[model samples]
Each structure stands twice: as structure tokens, then as C-alpha cells.
Target: MYKVPKLNNQGTEGLEYLYIDSNGNIETSKDHSKLINDPDGVLGNTLKPLLKLPTSMPKDFGFITYNDQPPPDDKGVTPSVNSKFGHSKGLVMMDKTTGVWLLHSVPKFPFKRDNNFYPTSGAAKAQTFICVTFKYAEFQKIGQHLLDIAAFPFESHFPADFHDQLKKAAIIKWNNREPGEKIQDLESDAGTQFKSIAKKLYKGKMSACWLESEDLT
Candidate 1:
């Protein structure tokens, strides 16, 4: 099993859960109960102002989510397609300076863009995630990586002047595209350096090193 680092209020450089309180205060908390949880089986309509672009982002911003399983409508009818396409699930939100990419294993989540509710369906099982904060320039490579994986954006919004790769990623539809990979050395704003190997339909070795703490427990 992998060890998770201890979280604290001043800890912004390592693994930490971003929790927004009802008062719109963004804080890092180890208490799961303090985090928002939706016990009712319904999509929340409450708008999280804390997640607004002008509030959370330093400047102009945009976001997009790619998932194979579309959220069921109010009538409980799921949208269907003629062909089987991408199956990746993730969300990428960014601004002119920085961005957040959340890669998750949850399906039928994020039913709407206005709310920040965690679905009951996703809570049934332990979901895995790889959330990273990267500089705006790195998003260009990230957009290209999504295209290589043929991730279909079920929901997306971005400025016209933003990276062209991001626009292309928002409209991915075909699954017959050739497989590819893009390797890059990336450095976070916090000075953490790492290499990323994005692959599609290929077998390869995956490795990463986190030197933030000597003891990950």
C-alpha cells in the first residue's frame, strides 16, 4: 500500500484535499466530515461561489470534463451514442497563470457545472484520483495528451484565445484515431520537478518520485 502524507493548514506543496466551507473559506482539512458530502440521492443545485472563476482563479479562466458515462437526466434516462468512444474520466480547469487537472475513477459524476456535489454513486466505492496543479503553459501539453487518449469532453467551456489544443480536446468524437504518446519533463510552480508519459493503446513502464517528505505515512 502507498502511504499518504500528513495534511496541515500551511501545507500547500503536497497532497491535500481542497475543502471549501459553507462560508466560502478554502481550507485544507483532514476531517472527512468537514468536507461536503451529499447523502441524498439527488444532484445538488446549490452554486458554489467559491468555485467561480473570478473567485478561485486569478484571471480569466475555463474548465472542461471528459467522461464516457454521461450523467443521467432528471428523467433518469442516460444519453446514448451510436459508437463506443473514449472512456477516460477527468476534469481540467485553468486560467492564464495556473490550472488544476483532476483525474478520477468516478463515473456519472459532476452532473452539472454549477454545483460541487459529490454523487452517492461515486461514494459506493473508493475512488482514485491524481490531481495536479500545473502552470498554464503545461496545459498545452496536457490538452495534447487528452487528444492522444481520445477523451471525449461531455462538458466544456474555454475562451477563444486559449490554447488551440484545449479547443480540439473539447470536441473529440472519433475513436478510430491512431494511438500515440507524448513524454515531457514538467516542473510545478512550487519547484517540484517530474516527468510525464502520456500513452494510448500501448504498453509502457510508469514511474514517479515524490520527494516532498521522507516518510509518506
Candidate 2:
């Protein structure tokens, strides 16, 4: 499994869950109930401001990522924008109506919402993540053309337009695609292949490193 790198805030380590109470006061607690469970703290304080960019899209977007696999298997390695944590991977989704881009990550916090102390063994993965947004159409073009990463687990896809020529091409491609059984055979190692391909993609102009800070707004 991937180990999310810890971050520091005002000298506090791994304090990303702190939230603001009413009256705009920063609040936290040692008992753990005070820990944040929603996305607002970061969104309201840090993100909303950067989203000032004008967008004609409906302002809708979301994220997609594969669930973690049980250990003792070759789980995939992802390159994180946070170099301190190395790299992480996830899917990117959009609402065509909205121009917002959501970075994806698996949310398996170390603590349960109700428990103040560590719980029993074999709980969810203790991973770290940052909640942020970006402008849509940031990437020049995206498609299955050579594993263009829209998300993991290979979710549903549809034709972006209803043009006759596009439809014909899609139908031909669909019929020519691998059979379902073939896809299942590859599923076991798909993530590993995805990671390898993503690395090679960075050599071209289609990729970005978190180190470079690809800002949309």
C-alpha cells in the first residue's frame, strides 16, 4: 500500500483535519470529535478564493479512484504532487457543465470519526490527502488514446458529441476492442501498468508534476 506523506501546518504535523467553528474561530480538540469530517475548512479558507476564475460551465465536477487492495499483493505506486510523500494516483472527473477540476485521493484516515484513540488492526489505510480544485480543460485533450488518465477502475464513458462521423468511429472501435474476458484477465495488473504508462507520459507535454504546481485559477 502507498504511504501518504505527512504535512505540517503552523508547526502542527498532519493537522489537515482541523476545522473552523462558527464565528470563524479555528477549532481543534485532543478528544478527536473536534477533528474535521467535511471539506469546508480547506475549501472555504484556502480553495474558494482561488476559484475566482470565470467559468461558463455549470460549475460541477468530482473525483474517481480505485479502492486499495489487500496487502501481500503488488499494489500500484503513484507519483504524488507532494514530493515529501512521493506520489499518489487517482481519477479525474468533470461535469462538462462545470469547469472545476477535482484532484482525487483515497480517504482512509487514521482515526474513526467517533473514536478518539486508534482502533483495532486492519482498519482502513492511513493515507493523507489535500482537497483542492482546478480549472477544467486544463489538459489539452484526454481520451483512451494510449491510457489517458481520466480515472481508475475504468469507469463508464460516452461519446462527447452526437456527430455522425464520431458515432460511426466509436462503433467500429467498440467492436474491435478486447472482449470482456480479456479485460478481466488484465484487471489484476492494470494499476501497475497504469503507473508505468503515466510515468512515460510525463516525458511528453501532457502531464504535470505537483512540484511544478499546475494552478488553474
Candidate 3:
């Protein structure tokens, strides 16, 4: 079994549950009710503004069980993946805008990748990845909202056509293609298009740690 990490809120420590299985998947659990009443107090008021939506009774929420076993001797040490906690059975919150009843269990992991990895040729053995269960309606709504925000900038400075182009450029970048590949595979004009729009919309206003700030910059 994996150990549960301590959660701190304004110098107070809260109870948390850890569910781990033999295959190396780990998840943290917390009471959804506590989170709803004290969302700002818990997350240091960081997510208060973004969580403007009203709290609702979670139709579905619980912990996911999974195996947490390390790879065999020949496989070597696998890099750690970050953990995220939430009220929903899945790590994702039901509503991105106003779901204060959810708690996130973010872990310090060495690798930066989605929590899905399958052992291939080099591994000594095979392992099964755990899929988190969630309510259909809640998942769809949150997923769509996030897609809209990530694909299209909410700012008014960029035109609709420019936003669409920027979304395409972002998709290209997400695929980890080289500049030349992006140009050939995606929009041939992607090169100057994203640059021009980005320069105009975010002139001297971008920061590496935007989430750390009190307000959107």
C-alpha cells in the first residue's frame, strides 16, 4: 500500500486517504463535504475566483482502487507520476467553474506526463493501468468547458479567425512536433500566424508562474 501525504490548510492538517494496489496506481481520498464549505480556506484562496459556480450535491464520488506494485528487478526504477485528488471518483472535478466540493491531491512526481503508461519491450513484466470512474453528465460538462477555454482564448483582443488559428497551433505544439513538421503537417502558414497573434495579444504580459499570482495577469 502507498502512504497518504499530509494535506495542509492555513496551518491546519486535514485527514486524507490513500488507495493503492499492486500495480503502482495511487489515488488520494478526502471528504467532499468539507471541501464545499471551505474551498477558499483550504486552497489558500488561490482557486476562489475560478470557482465561482455554485456547489451542488455530487451525484457520484468515491475512491478508485488500483494496484501499486513497482516493476520487477529487471525493469529498473520507473519515474514517478504526479497524483491529483478530487471529490469525483476520477481525479477531475465535476464542474470546472464552480465545483468547490472537490479536493485535489497533487503529488510531487519526477516525470511530467499523463498518468497512463504501458510497459513495452524493456519491461520485465506487464502491468495494468487503472481507469478512474466518473459520472457521465458531470464529466462531459467539465470536459467540454475545459476544451473551450484551452482551445479558445477568453480574451477579446484576438479575432475569432485568429483564435481558431491559435487553437490549431496549440494542438500542433501539444503533439510535440518540430517547427518544420508542424508547418508541413498542420497549417503551412502556422509559423508566422501564431507568432503574430501571440505578440499582439500577450505583449510583455506573460509569466512562467501565472497560477502563482493572485489574479490573472
| Per-model TM-score on C-alpha atoms | 0.63, 0.31, 0.19
Q: Return the top candidate by lDDT.
A: 1
lDDT by residue (1-217, candidate 2, tens digit) is 1122343433323333433432456534333433222224332233232223223223343322222221121243331222111133333334443222223243322122122212232223333333322233331122232132212222222234422322222232343332111111111111211111322122335555555557866
Segments in model 2 whose C-alpha atoms lie over 4 Å from true places: 1-63, 67-88, 97-125, 139-151, 154-197, 201-217
Residue 32 lDDT, candidate 3, scale 0-100: 34
What digit string (tens of lDDT, one per residue) describes model 3 on residues 35-122? 2123333332323333322222232321111111222222445423122111111123223222222222222110111121212221
Superior by TM-score: candidate 1 or candidate 3:
1
Indicate the TM-score of model 2: 0.31
- Per-residue CA lDDT of model 1 for 116-190, tens digit only, reads 445545544444555567899988888877777777677677888899888888875534443456777777656
Clashes of 3: 14
Greater TM-score among 2 and 3 belongs to 2
Q: Is candidate 1 or candidate 2 better by lDDT?
A: 1
Candidate 1 TM-score to native: 0.63
